[model samples]
Structure formats: structure tokens, C-alpha cells
Target chain A: MLELKNVSAGYGESSVLKGVSTTFEKGKLTSIIGKNGCGKSTLLKSILGILPLSSGKVVVDGNNLHSMSRNEIAKKVAYLAQGKSTPDMTVEQMVLHGRFPHLSYPRRYQEADREIARKAMGVVGIYHLADKPLFTLSGGTRQNAYIAMALAQDTDYILLDEPTTYLDIAHQRELMNLLVKLANRGKGIITVMHDLPLAFNFSNTVAVIQNGTVVAHAEPSEICGSSVLDEVFGVKIERLPNDKFYYDY
Target chain B: MRCYMKSLPKNKIANIYGIAILLLILSAVLGVLLGASGISLTDMLSSLVKGDIESPEVKILLYVRLPRILSGLICGAALAVSGAVVQGVLANKLASPSIIGVNAGAGLAVILCSAFGMIGGWSLSAFAFIGAFLTVMLVSIAAKKWGASRGTVILMGVALNALLGAISDTVITFNPDVSVMSNDFKIGDFSSVTYAELIPAAVIVLITFLVLITLSNELDVLTLGDENAKGLGMNTSLMRVVFLLMSALLAGAAVSVCGLLSFVGLLVPHAVRRMAVTESKHLIPLCALFGAGFVAVCDTLARVVFAPYELPVGIIMAFLGAPFFIFILIRGKGGHRNA
Candidate 1:
């Protein structure tokens, strides 16, 4: 389990996350949703240790994240950043980089590492495009390739920042399904999302952040029943009779 | 479905390695045999086997041509590998040692040392290394201070190159006694390289190559930008500094020996990337082999084309490298990253 207790973090001169406490349970898909500039991404970075916490502690399985080396943290948690540049590498090469923390000294990838990368690519359904350069792949397929890279890390927890951005509706649905599948495989999957319906439908737990603090942390049903999203986003969310949702600004 | 997506077949890479080694050998042999006093292949082989330094043929081969040939091979490989690492670390294809002020900086230091009559042996190379390292550090610091974008860094390098070139010219002007020597050094020639001058550089280049090859995997991960690399558990800043120091060591060592040779660093890496895999492990070795061959052949041509009146190898490299650089610019491959 990864837990952040009263954490505050931000860029220079401007705080984005303030005293936000949250726990991401293992084997569950947790969706972080909030308005733009509401510290959704900042909170993720704080937990990943990419951003230094201004106050408070982030603990992973009873060990303080701040006390561990970057390599140690990477061994337990994998991260997929949003909208990476297209490196001049094939999907297989990109996925193999995930094994970096596992190897030492000369850092040669052994047969076992290759097998794991291949399996990770298979999990994301990009096994067919492994040899193709990432620049040649479609946006959605590229997203899948990055996911394959994250999966290849073989960690218990994976964090993604807006994995669905720039992806088409079909690709978004496929990615959400893949995330849920990964969560079902006993990995804690945490993602920052903008799509309310998809987050509500797919995630086992929903964390709603407003003004740099998490105002609501509950199950999808409980969040949907409350007025959290409407209050945070300054919009009216209506639940239709047919089990669909509509948002009116 | 188990789809095996192999990027480049193993045989193809093996073939590339084979071709590169063969070319290197061919160029090396030609470099030795085609110098001013031509020695036939059989004669050269017999001289090598006889091991008689007293014989005129053996003396010329051992004392004169052998060091020049070795210098070309080592310097060419050094510059090319340095360029490839710089390009990878900066994530910019245009980031060669020559273009990024490393060669010019080393050249200024060597010229300054010569002007002060502090020439020869390890001291000159040490001075050159310090100059190269300082220039790279300055450029990186300035770039970081001023937004640190790819374009910004390249522009800063250009500015630094111009400044260093001007300083070199000033140093040469004040010391007219060393004017002729400075001119030859500026254009880059291997005729003056003796064994005494070549040994230190050779050792540094060889050791640096070995160390870099061991870290090639880390270099590949570094090309994926900082945040991503850190996410993969790499100390990205530390690796960048180490790579930059290695680049300086290579450029400084080569410049200290052969003056300021241009474009082998820029051209060889680009050419190798076109033919083989982009992975640094494969790219670094292939660049070393192909680069050695390319410069050796170019040096041989420079020696033979003008007959008794030899041209510096830099002229030939410039003629080739300038056009390719422009082509890269026109093709929009020079600046790949917005940052």
C-alpha cells in the first residue's frame, strides 16, 4: 500500500498540493479526478517522489518514500508520464528500458529480462508492433507502447498521468479496460483522469481534489451519490434515468 | 498471439560489424602504403616480419608512416564516438563536439600553450582537456540559465566557438614565430605527430572508449529525457555530467594530437545511425570502426590527391561535412526536440 499523509508540494513560489492525505490500496484501480490546476498531477508526482514534499510524509508499505533511493522506489512503483516525445526507438527497445532498475553495473538485459519485456508488450496488445519504431505508430498504439513499458517494470504499483490524453474514444476505452485488467492482476493502478463517466465506471475508488486538497475519497458509487464533482468543478452533473450521466456548465 | 517483433535481424548487425572491420583494415593498410614514399604491400609486410629498424624501408615504415596511420585511426574513432555520445546525451543530432565548441576550446588551449612555448608531452594534453571540460561546462551552465532549450544550447555553442576561434587567432598573431605551426594545427594535419605525442592521447582515448562502452546501456536510457529516465531509476544529472566529461576527454585528446580535425565526429555517427541500430551499444562500436576507416581513407586521399603538396585532412572533411550538415538542417533533422 502507498500512503501520503498531510503532504504539501509545489513548484517554486507556488503551492499546488497542500496537506492532501490519500491511500492507494493494492490490487485496486484508483482514479484521481479534479478540475484543471486542482493538484491532480502534483499529487501523483508527490507520491512518486518526483516532487519533494513541502511538508508531511509519503509511506510505501511502512517504509518512508523519502528515505528510499530513486532506484528503490522505482523497484516498487512504475510511472508512465503523460505525452512523451517519440524517441527513435522500436517498441521492444522502449520496453526494455523498464528493466534498467533491475540490472546493475554494465546493465545488460539478460534473457529473463527480455522475456519479461515481451510478456509486458503482450499484455498491452502491442506485441505485433514491437519491431516498429514508436514514431510510426498511431497515437493510441503509442500510448499502448508506453503502457507496455510501464508494465515491463513488473512492479506492484503503476501510476499514469492522463494516459488517455490525445487518444480517440475507442483507444481511451481500450486503455481503461487494460488498466482495469492490470488492477485485476493484483497491481495497484493509479491514474489521473478527466473523464468523469469513465473514472466512475472503471475505478474501484475515486479521489476528488479541489483547491490543492482531496475533498472526497470514496468508492465510485459513493462519489457518484454525493455532490463532490459538481462542487469541485463548479458545474451541474445530472444522473439520467437510463443510468447515464450528463454535465451542464 | 506470440508475435516476435525483432527490430533488426541478428545476421544484419553481424554483417555490419564485419563490413566495418574490413573497411577499417583496408583503410589502415592503404594509409600506410600510399604515403609520400610509396612502399608496396609485400615490401611493407616483409619489413614488418624482418623487424630490422636499421633498414631504410623499415625505418621509414616504423618511424614515419606507422605513427601517422595509428594517429588517424585513434583520433578518428575518438572524435566519432565522442560525437555519438554527445548527440545521445543532448538528444539533439546536431550536438557534435566541433559544433558545440569542444574542439575549438581545445584548439585554443593548445595554441595558447604553443605560443607560450609550453608544448609537447602530457602537459599540453592536460591543458587541452581542461579547456574542453571548462567550455562544455560553461555552455551547459549558460544554456540552463537561459531556458536550456535545444536551440538555445546550439546557439550558445556557436557563440562560444566564435569567441574561442577569435582568441586562438589573437594568440597566433602575437607569436609570429609559431605562426606556421599554428596554421597547420588549425587546419589539422597528422604529419607532425610522433610516437611521443601520440601515446598519452592513445591511452586516454582507449580507456575512455572502454569505459563508455560499459555504460552504453545507461546512455540509451538517458536519451529518453530526464524525468522519464529518473522514473526508470537513473541519476540523470550525474550521468549527463559524466557523459559530457567523457566527450571532453575524447575531443581534447584528439585535438591535442592532431590539432582541430572537424566533421569526423559529426559525420561518422550520422552515417552509422543510417546503416545500423540506434541503440548506443551497437552505435558506439560501429561508429568507432567506421569512423576510423572513413578518416583514414580521407587522409590517404588528401595525401595522394595533391601529390608532393599535401592538403590537410580537415579540408576534405570540411568539404564533405559542411554539405551534410546543411542537408540535415534542410531535412529538419537537426532539431528534433522542442525543448
Candidate 2:
């Protein structure tokens, strides 16, 4: 389990996350949703320790996250940044880097590391593209490649920031389905998403952030009944006949 | 399948290594054989085997040509590997010791030491490394202060290069006795290199190379950008500093020996990347070998192309390197960064 207690973080002098507290349970898919500039991404960065905490602490399995080394944190949490450009390398070469924290000095990937990487790529259904340069892959496939790299880390928790951005509707569905599948297999997954319908439909838990603080942390069905979405997003959400909610400004 | 198309088979990697080794050997032999002294390959080899260090031909081969050739190989490898690391760390293909003011900074430092009559070989090399390290630090600070965009960093380097070059010129103008020495340093020739002068640089370069090889995996992670690298459990800032220090040591050692030889750093790494994959594990070693060969061959041509009239290897490198630099800019490979 990962827990953030009154975590406040910011960039330079401007605070973005002010006393945001949230707990992410294992074996569950949690969607963090908020309006633009509501600290959704900032909260994720704070959890990953990429942003220094202005106040409070992040604890993982009873150990303070700040006390752990970067490699130690990496063994427990895998992160997929929003969008990243890699150098000219094949998918396999990129995925092998996930084993970096696992190897010692004069690091060389052994047979066991290779087997793990291969299995990770297989899990993402990109085993065939392992040899192909990432530059040549489609946007959707590139996201999958990054996911495969994260999976190769073999962590219990995975955090993604806008994994569905720039992806087509079909690809988004594919990615969401993959995340759900991972969650079902006993891995904790947290993602920052903008699509309310998808977030409500697929996530086991929904975290709603407003003005740099998490206002609601509940199951999707429980969140759907409250007026919090209207107050947080500044828009009225109507329940549609097809079991979907429509936002009207 | 896409996988089949992208895979780097083991056999191909082996072939690339084989070709690089072959080129290195061929160039080294040529470097030893063809010089102003007119020693043929067969005679040199026969004398070397017989341990005939007394003959004039053998003397020239052992005392003059051997050290010069070895200097060329070491200097070339150092500059090339430095360029490879700079490019990787900066995430900009245009980043090299020469272009990013490292060579110029070292050159300025060496000239300053010479002007001040600080002529100790080891002290001179130490000064060069300090100068190179300071220059890179300045460039990095400026880039960070404004924005660390690739263009901003390269432009800052260019500005620093001009300023350091001017200072070096002023120092040389006041010290007339050091003018002749400055001329050789500026043009970058290997004719004046002695075993005593080459020893310190050779040791530094070898040690740095070994250290870099051990850190090649970390370097690969760095190319993915800071946040991504941190997410993978790397201390990105610390890694960057270490890599830059290694790069400075490499360029500083080479510059201490050969003056300001340009473009081997840029051209060799780019050429090696084209021939092989971009993984630092392969790139660093291949760049070192291929770069050594490339400069050795270029130096041999500069020596023998015009009989009895020697051209500085830097001049030859400039003629070859300038066009390639332009080509890289036009192709926009160095300009590649996500907005």
C-alpha cells in the first residue's frame, strides 16, 4: 500500500499540491480526475518523489518513501510518464533498461533479466516489435512499448500520467482494458485521466481533486451519485440512457 | 513482423566489432609505415622483430613514429568517446567537445599555462582539465538559467568558445616567446609529441575509458531525459555530472597532447552511430576504436600526401568535419526534441 499524508508540493515558489492526502489500495485501479491545473499530474509526481514535498510524508508499506533510495522506490513503484521521446533504439533495448535497478556495478543483463524482459514484452503484446526501432512505431504502439518497459520493472504498483493522450478511441480502449487486466491480476494501477466516462466505467476507485486537494476518494458507483463532480468541474453532469454520464457546461 | 525488422541480431553486432577492429589495425599499420622518414612496412617490421633499435630506420620507427602513432590513436579515441558521451547526456547530437567549448577551453588553459611558464607536463594537463570542466559548468549553468533547450545550450557554448579564444589570443600576443608554441597548439599537430608528454594523457584517457565503460548502462538511461530516468531509480543529476566530468577528462587529456584537434569527436561518434546501434555499451567502445583509426588514417595522409611538407592533422579534420557538421544541422538530427 502507498499512502500520502498531507502532502504539499510545488514548483519554484508557486504551490500546486496543498495538503493533498490520498491512499491507494493494492490490487485496484484508481483514476485521478480533475479539471485542468487542479494538481492531478502534480499529485502523481509527488507520489513518485520527482517533486520534493513542501510538507508531510509519503509512506510505502510502513517505510517512509523519502528514506528509501531511488532504486529501492523503483523496485516497488513503476512509473510511465505522460509522453517521452527516446533515443534511436529498438523496443527490446529500451525494455532492458528497466532491469537497471536490479543489476549491480558493471551492469550487464543476464539470462534471467532477458527472460523477464521478454515476458514483459509478451505481456504487452509487443513481442513481435521487440526488435523494431521505437521511432518507426505508431503512437499507440509506442505507448504500449513504454508500458512494456514499465512492466519489465516487475513492480507491484504502476503509475501512469495521461497514458491515453494522443491515442485514438480504439487504442484508448485497448490501453484501459490492459490496465484493468493488470489490476485484476493483483497489481495496483493509478492513472491521471481526463475522460470522465471511461474513468467512471473502468476504475475500481475514483479520486477527484479540486484546487490542489483531493475532495473525494470513493468507489466509482459511490462517486457517481454525489454532486461533487458538478462543484469540482464547474459543470452539470447528466446520466445518459446508455449508462454513461454527459457533462454539460 | 515488426519484431523481426527491429531486432539486432547477435551476429550483426559481432560483424560490426570485427570491421572496427580490422579498420583500427589497418590504420595503425599505415600510421607506422607512411611518414616523412620514408620507412617501408616490411623493413620496419623486420627491424622491430630483430630488436634492432640502433639502425636509423629502426630509430625513427621506435623513437619518432611509434610515439606519434600512439598519440594519434589515444587522442582520437579520447575525443571520439568524449563526443559520444556529450551527445548522449545533452540529448543533442550537435553536442561535442569542440562545439560545446570543451576543446577550446582546454586550449585556452594550455596557452595560459605556457604563457605563465608553467611548463610541467602533468600540471599543464591538470590545468587543461580544470579549464574544460569550468567551461562546461558555465555553459550548463547558463543553459539552466535560461532554458536547457538544445539550441540554447549549443549557442551558449559557441559564445563561450569565442570569448575563450579571444583571451587566449591576447595572452599569446603579450608573450612573444610562446608564440611559436601557441601556433603548434592552435593548429593541433602530433609531430612534437614525445613519450614523456604522451604518458600522462595516455594514463588519464585509459582510466576514464574504463570508468565510462562501467557506467555505459547508466548513460543509456540518461538519454531518456531526467524525469524518466529518475522514475527508473537513477540519480539523474548526479549521473549527468559524472558523465560531464568524464567527457571533460577525455577532451582535456587529448587537448593536452594534440592541442585542439577538432571534429574527430563529432565525426567519429556520428559515423559509429550510423554503422551500429545507439546503445552506449556498443557506441562507446566502437566510437573509441573507430575514432582512433579515423584520426590515425587522417594523420598519415596529412604526413605523406605532400612529401616533405607536413600539414597539421587539425587542418585535415576541419576539411572533413565542417561538411559533416553542416549535414547534421541540415538533417535536423541534432534539433530533434519534443516541444
Candidate 3:
């Protein structure tokens, strides 16, 4: 479990996350949904220790996030930031980088590391695209490559920020299904989602942020038919059968 | 065609390495054998075989052509590898040693060293590295602070390059006594190179390059960008600083040896990339080899193209690099692939 204790973080002088207290449970896919500039991404970064918490603590299991080294923290959790650019390298090389946190200085990618990477690529079904350069692949395939990289990190918790942003609907759905699959395998999958209907329906729990604070954190059905989504996102969401939902546009 | 579309596989990259080594060897042989000396390659080889090191041909081969050729290789490799590193770390394609003020920084340092009297080779290289390190760090920090975009970083580099060049000119103007500030040095020539000057710079470049090669994987991870690199547990800031420092060392040592040889850094890496050499392990070593061969070949042309009256090697580089840079711009690959 990753727990945030009254976390406050921001860029330079302007505080973005004004005391955002939240807990990301293990073995479940949690979706953080918020309006633009509501500190949803900022909150994820804070949890990953990518953005320094101004006033609170990020506790992973029992270890404090800030006290740990980057690698040590990486061993505890993996992160996938938004807007991943395609670098010039083979997909296998990209996946192999996931084994980076496991290596020490004078970092070597040994056979074991290669095995792990191969396993990761297999997990995301990108094993066939292993030899292909990342830049040549389509949006969905590239997202899989990146997710494969994250999976290769082999951490208990994997955090992604808007993984579906630039991808098309089909790719987005494919990515959500993959995330759900990973979550089903008992990995703690936490993603900052922009697609409200997808987030509320697909994730095991939904974290709704308003003005840098999580105004509602509960099971999607528990928050359904409530006024929180309307107040926070300024939209109405109708819950459908079988725990699915749609925006009342 | 498929090979051109993607990063080369290990064996293909090795094959390219094979080609690069051949080019370097051919350039070195030509550099040693084809000067203004009336002595033939046969004469020099036969003399060395006979242990007759006193011959004028052998002396020229051993002393003049050899040092010049060696320094060309060292300087060329240094600059090119450094350029590859800069391009990777900053994740900008337009940034190179010359554009990013590294050459100017080292040029200023060399000029200052000359003004202080012709100091030892080590101190000159050290001063050059210090100067280059400072300039690049300033540019990097400023870019970070401003949250400069990919193109913005290159623009910042252009501005810094111009600023540093102006300062160098000012220093040169003030200290006309400094011989290194003369036209030949500014344009980058190996005509006056000595063993004392070449050895120190060579040592630094080689060592720094090897260190960079060991950290090449980190460099690859770095190109993944700050957030991903940190997510992968890399200390992004530290690795960036280390890479920048190594790059400075390389640019400095090369500049210390041969004034400011522009475009070897700019040209060789781009050319290597066109060959589909993407990762730093392949990128750095290959750049070193190709850069060395390319500069050696250029310097030989400078020496013999006009015969006794030699043009500076920098002229050849400019003649080549400027056009190639334009071609890249026209093709719209001048920015980062995704940028």
C-alpha cells in the first residue's frame, strides 16, 4: 500500500497540491480523475517522489518515499509519466531499461536482466516486437512497449499519468484493458485518468480531485448517483448495469 | 531499406564499426605517407625496417606527420563523441559542441592560457575543460530553470555560443600577444602541434571516452527524458551532470590540442545517425572512429590538396558541415525525432 500523509507539493512558489491526503490500496486498479490543473498529475508525481512533497510524507508500505534513494524507491514502485516520446532504439532495448533499477553503479544488463525483460515483453504481448525500433510502432503498440517497460520494472505498484491521452479510442481501451489485467494479477495499478467514464467504470476505485484536494475517494458505485462528480467535474455521469457508466452529455 | 529505417542490429553495427576502423587506418596511413615530403611510403617503410631512423623521410614520418595525424584522430574523436553525448543528454538534435558554446569556451581558455605564457600541455587542457564545463553548465542550468523546450534549448545554445564567441574575440583583441588567438588557431590547424601538446589532451580524451562508454546505458536511459529516467531509478540530474562534465572534458581536450575545430562534432554524429546508429554504446564508439577518420582525411587533404601551401582543416570541415546541416534542416530532421 502507498499512503500519502497530508501531502502538499507544487511547482516553485505556487502550491498545487494543498494538503492532498490519500491512500492508494494494493492489488486494485485506482483511477485518479480531476479537472485540468486540479493537481491530479501533481499528486501522482508526489507519490512517486518525482515531485517533492512540500509539507507531507509519502509512505510506501512502511518505508518513507523521501528517505529512500531513487533506486530503492524504484524497487518499491514504478512510474510511467504522461507524454512519452519515442526515442531511437529497439523495443527490446526499451524493455531492458526496466531492469535498470535492479542494477547498481557500473550498471550491467546481465542475462538475468535480459530474462526479466523478455518476461516483461511477453507479459504485455510485445515479445514479437522486441527487435523493432520503438519509433516505427503504432500508438497502441508503443503504449504497450512502455507498459511492458513498466511491467519489467517488477515493482508492486505501477503508476501511470494519462497513459491514454494521445492514443486513439481503440488504443485507449486496449491500454485500459491491459491496466485492468495487470491489476487483476495483484499488482497495485494507479493511473491518473482523463477519460471520466472510463476511469469511473474500469477502475476498482476512483479518486476524484477538486482544487488540488481529493474531495471524494470511494468505490465507483458508492460515488455513483452522488453529487461529487457533478460538483467536481461539472458533469453528470449515469451509472449503467454491470458497474459500467457514461457521461450524461 | 529496412536497415535504414531502424537502428542497426548488433552485428550490422559491428560491421559498421569494421568499416569505420578501416577508414581510420586508411586515413592514418595516408596522413603519414602523403605530405610535402619527397620521401615515398616505400622509403619510409624500408628505412624503419632497416632501423635507419635518421633519414629525413623517417624523421618526417615519425615526428611531423605522425604527431599531426595522431592529434587529428584524438581531437576529432573527442569532439564527435562529446557532440553525441550532448545531443543525447539534452535530448536535442541541433545542439553540438560548436553550437552549444563548448568550443568557444575552450577557445577562450586556450587563448587565456597562451596569454599567461605557453604553459604545459596538462594545464592548458585542464583550463579548457574548466572553461567548457562552466559554459555548458550555465546553458544547461538556464535551460532547466526556464523549462526550455527542445528548440528553445538549441536557441539558448546559439545565444550562448554567440556570447562566448564575442568574449573570446574581446579577449583576443585585448591580448594580441597571445599567439593561439591568431587566425590559424581560431580556424583550427594542426600545423604547429607538438608531442607535449598532443599527449595530455589525448590521455584525457581517451580516459573520459572510456568512462562515458561504461555509462553509455545510462545515457540511453537519459534520452528517455527526466521523468522516465527518474522513474527507472536513475538520478537524472546527477547522470546529466556527469555526462555534461565528460562532454566538457572531451571538447576541452580536443580544443586544447587543435584550437577550435568546428563541425567534426556537428557532422560526424549526424552522419553516424543517418547510418542508424542510435544507442550511445554504438553511438559513442562509432562517432569516435568516424570522427577520427573523417578529420584525419580532411587534415590530409588540407596538407596535400594545395600541396606546400596548406589550408586549415577547419576550412574543409566548414565546407562540409554547413551544407550537411542545411540538408538536415531541409529534410526536417534537425529537431529531435519526436520534438
Ranking by lDDT: 3, 2, 1
The Cα error of candidate 3 at residue B194, in Å, is 0.8
Identify the CAPRI category of the predicted complex in candidate 1. Answer: medium
For model 3 the TM-score comes to 0.95
Where does the lowest 10-residue lDDT sum fall in candidate 3 chain A? A240-249
Q: Which candidate leads in lDDT?
A: 3
Question: Candidate 1 on A201-237: residue-level lDDT in tens?
Answer: 7889989999999999998777777888768876655
- Stretches of candidate 3 off by over 4 Å are B1-8, B320-336
Across A36-145, the per-residue lDDT of candidate 3 in tens digits comes to 99998898788888888889899988888889988988888898889787888889899889989999868888877787788887778888788888888998899899
Which wins on DockQ, candidate 1 or candidate 2?
A: 2
**Weakest ten-residue segment in model 1 chain A by summed lDDT:** A236-245
Q: Determine which window of 10 residues in candidate 3 chain B has minimal summed lDDT.
A: B1-10
Clashing pairs in 1: none
TM-score of each: 0.94, 0.94, 0.95
Can you give the lDDT of residue B190 in candidate 3?
A: 93
CA lDDT, candidate 2, residue B163: 91
Q: Could you tell me which residue pairs clash in candidate 2?
A: A128-B3, A131-B6, A131-B7, A132-B6
Q: Summarize candidate 2's per-residue lDDT along A164-233 as a digit string, tens digits.
A: 9999989998999989988888889999999887788789999999989999999876887888997887
Candidate number with the higher TM-score (1 or 3): 3
C-alpha RMSD of candidate 2: 2.8
Q: On residues B64-162, what C-alpha lDDT tens digit does candidate 2 reach at each position?
A: 888989999999999999999988888888888988899999988888887888654788889888888888777766775776788888888888889
